[model samples]
Target: MFTRILIANRGEIAARVIGTARRLGIATVAVYSDADAGARHRDLADEAVHIGPAPVSESYLKGDRIIAAALATGAEAIHPGYGFLSENPEFVEAVEAAGLVFIGPSAASIRAMGLKDAAKALMSSVGVPVVPGYHGERQEAGFLAAEAARIGYPVLIKARAGGGGKGMRLVEAPADFAAALESAQREGRSSFGDPAVLVEKYVSTPRHIEVQVFGDRHGQLVHLWERDCSLQRRHQKVIEEAPAPGLPPEVRRAMTEAALRAARAVDYVNAGTVEFIADGSGPLRPDGFWFMEMNTRLQVEHPVTEAITGLDLVEWQLRVAAGERLPLAQAEIPLAGHAFEARLYAEDPARNFLPAPGPLLHVAFPDGARIDTGVGTGDRITAHYDPMIAKLTTHAATRAEALSRLRRALGQTHIAGTATNLGFLRALCEDPDFAAGRMDTGLIGRRQEALTRVPPPDDAAVLFAALAALDLDPARPFLGFRLWGSASRRVELVSGGTLVARDLRLLGPRHVAVEEGDRSTAFEAVAATPDGFRARHGGRNLHARVVRAGGAVSVLLDGRITDFSVIDPLAVEAAGGAAENRITAPMTGLVCAVPVTAGATVARGDILVVLEAMKMEHSLRAASDGTVEAVHCAVGDPVGDGTLLVEFTPAARRPDEAADG
Candidate 1:
């Protein structure tokens, strides 16, 4: 084993690598950008180095800077944790040239699997089955359209060098092919600096299954098993599980064998994942699976595999990099119990899963579940990187039990200062199709309405928020009571964008009555704990926790987080004025294009500007027919959220039209 190693990444994966290195008595060095100077991963390392600024190009993606940091810190090996330069073959070669071990596969292996088009070709050359698609060298738009036509309708245009659903488009008809291809190419060029692409047949109901495989210098290889990652939204996996539930044994065996063969074919080393798309419209079969691509580094969902198999994948990466043989033979690897990992992100599920970066005021996870996180309370989710908060995983003797634990664990998780997908995840866990293992990549899309529904705040939650806002302590004497009778006060609160007035009356030191509209309820606080309160409402005991920040209060009760905004009745209101026609950015990002210019007349729904952030592009459209008055931003300019990008003037009306009106 090496004396020291440098982690060439940030966030949870870097922290995860540091944990294993610390347990092995090895010193770990962390490299951070300006935005991540105070991040949890930097604090967890024994030594740290400042790479550059926040943008990936100037910081994490700079291979030379990362190599220099590794050498300067005397790190014998560099572990590129799954993102940025993790799968960059050039970075691996550079680390090796600096006389430091790259704790992953060789440059040749990564290059072999770098481009999807070439990788699929190589896999097909071997015995591995591949999806029928056009992987040729033609890049002309006309030629690609011909290929898509040949492949039939509902084809997928994917960037050869893209992953994580970036630079991918699904076109269901021939008329949409050209525009989708152009969009995919543009994103591919912006993200990967490569505009090459490939066309493939779109699978209607496919299940995403990937196998974890590890190899060493001695040519020893072993498969750790499979994970079902079919639950997805916007082409990204939301929940993943190991020992895929209801998967046939024959299919599992075939997938494992194929994964091992792919690794050997590339002479792969260290940890890697071979992803396949299996037909889920019917029963699983050995011949119904096809190779999608291979991830040349550790996966974000590796924890689910670890939970099922009693092995640490990071330790194995280190051991393999240190010239040790595989830790366990293929037959000797242990597999037990079902495991599920839910990716808890600081994002709003209702707003098309928009990334919402803000401070984490209160963060807590439930017991009996393993939480791997890189942020804690008081940490801010910056816009410079991915907004994933943590990975919560649960394990049990059976799939049903494991899923139940996951549902409860998610409910126990408390968060504040930003919108989260906790509610959406809980709903997905309770989905009948999901519970029965009847899932596909389109499950979330088909059930989006029910999954992303935000329940209205109940009376109990509203009352709790009111109490917290007023700083009312039920245990205190008098509690601002009237001399003759119980003191009463009316408070205004807002929940889910609706303002509501609630009446609160203090009955005694430990009792209170709440009235909203035609309903009224009496409650008594039996005990007040640091974490929450134990109270009796309507003859039933209830447990609730309150998280207060500024004028916002989130009441967590009965596995639901209901947020209420305290309204200030005396605050001055802005005068009703003519509608301002300025279009501002919805989030911090770089302007990718300005489709409209000043003096240009555009129809409603016309694209005005395109903003790219967090690896996705969002097109700002004209809300109404208007003439562009000004274009304030240009392509390549980084703008903060709410920065004005364009201004428009309503289209002028003709004299005859005005007379008719």
Candidate 2:
């Protein structure tokens, strides 16, 4: 094995590679940009190298700079972790020219499967089942539209050089084809610098299943079963599992064999994934699966495969890069148990899953699970890269057990200072259809309302926050007693943008009554421990964990994390101010476009500006009918969160409305 290697990526994947390298006694070097100077991955490596600025183009995407760093640090090889330079054929060629081993497929192999259209053609030539589509090289808009018409309605326009759902659109009719194509091409150019796209038949009910395959320089190849990644939002996988449930035995065998054929056809080496979209109209069969695309590098969900197979895929990548033969025959690699992986991201599900980058005040993962993360408490989640916080995975002997464990693990995860999808993940795990394995790519879309609903703070959560804010000990006598008798204190909490005030009357040392409006509930604490408070309310006993960070308090109650901001009622009342009719950037990002100019009249819900951040586009809309007073930002200008982008003047009020007021 090579003694020293450089990881040519950032965040969790880089840290993940470092872990395996350390276990194998191989020294690892990590490269970082200006934004990731103090990143966890760099701190974990044996040595670190400063590349360039935070922008990926100047740092992570600069193949020559990365190669130079590797050579200067005496790294024997470079491991391009999933994204960025991982699938770039030119980068692979550059590394080879520098006489450093690239810990992945060769440049030729990557080129063969780099573009979706070309890869589809290659798969078809090799007898691999492929989705019917136009894989031609023509880029004219009219020709693409004609091809979509021939394919029938509800066709998909996918960028030839795209991944992670960027540069993809589904057109339901010919009328929308032109606009969708234009949008797709624009995103394609912005994201991949390639405007080429292909038209494909959109599967009405699709389940994403991919087979993990490995090959060595000695020409040995094998498949590591499959993972079902049907749970998706915005065309990105949210939850993934290994040993795909509800797949027929014959289908599994055929899929694995087909994957092996695809690998051999490209002369592929190292770790790669052959993705397939299966028809979910009925029971899964071998004939219902068709090739979608091949990811020419390690996948984000590879941990689920590792959990099921009891093998380290990163180690395999290193061994193959070192010219070692296949570690085991196909039959020797056993699939023992079912596993599930939930991608915990720092995003607000209610805000259409908008990326919310901020400091991680408190970060804690559950026990009995594997957490692969690149950030910790006190770390800032920068907008320069993906907003994925961690990948939590669990394995069990049965699918039911695995799902249950996954749900429990998600509930146990604690985070603060920024919004997260922990509640959404918990709801997904508890979904009946998901539990029964009736999942598809549209599952999240179909059940979005229920899955993203933010539950109100319960009484237990309010009480816990009150105790933490007041520094009151439930075990002590006369905790909230006045000179004459029990005291009544008003506690104010803010949750999910709604402010709630409750009156707490201390009846005794361990007893209190909480009054909210006309409703009141009495609770008696059995004991107060460092972990949580066990209390009885409404004839039921419950334990709620209290996590206090700064002025924010998060209570984990009944598998739901309810955050509360303990506020002073007097201060809140005194600080009230008139609303400023201004549209601000929701998060730090570059202003992509300003749709409205000064003095332009726009109705509520009209898009005023578009901001690009975290690899996604978000629009700032007018809050009310108003005229744009001034445009504060121009296209290509970088802005921070809450930075005013546009100022608007409210429309004139009617005479009757003014008289009433």
Poorest 10 consecutive residues by lDDT, candidate 2: 569-578
Candidate 2 per-residue C-alpha lDDT over 195-256 given as tens digits, one digit per residue, 9 for 90 to 100: 89999999999999999999999979999999999999878899999989999899999999
The alpha-carbon deviation from the true structure for residue 209 of candidate 1, after best TM-score superposition, in angstroms, is 0.6
How many residue pairs clash in each candidate at the backbone level?
0, 0
Inter-residue clash pairs, candidate 1: none
Expressed as tens digits, the lDDT of each residue in 276-303 for candidate 1 is: 9998999999999999999999999999
RMSD of 2: 2.4
List where candidate 2 sits over 4 angstroms from the true fold: 481-486, 568-581, 598-606, 622-630, 648-661
Residue 340's lDDT within candidate 1 is 98
Please give the TM-score that candidate 1 achieves against the real structure: 0.95
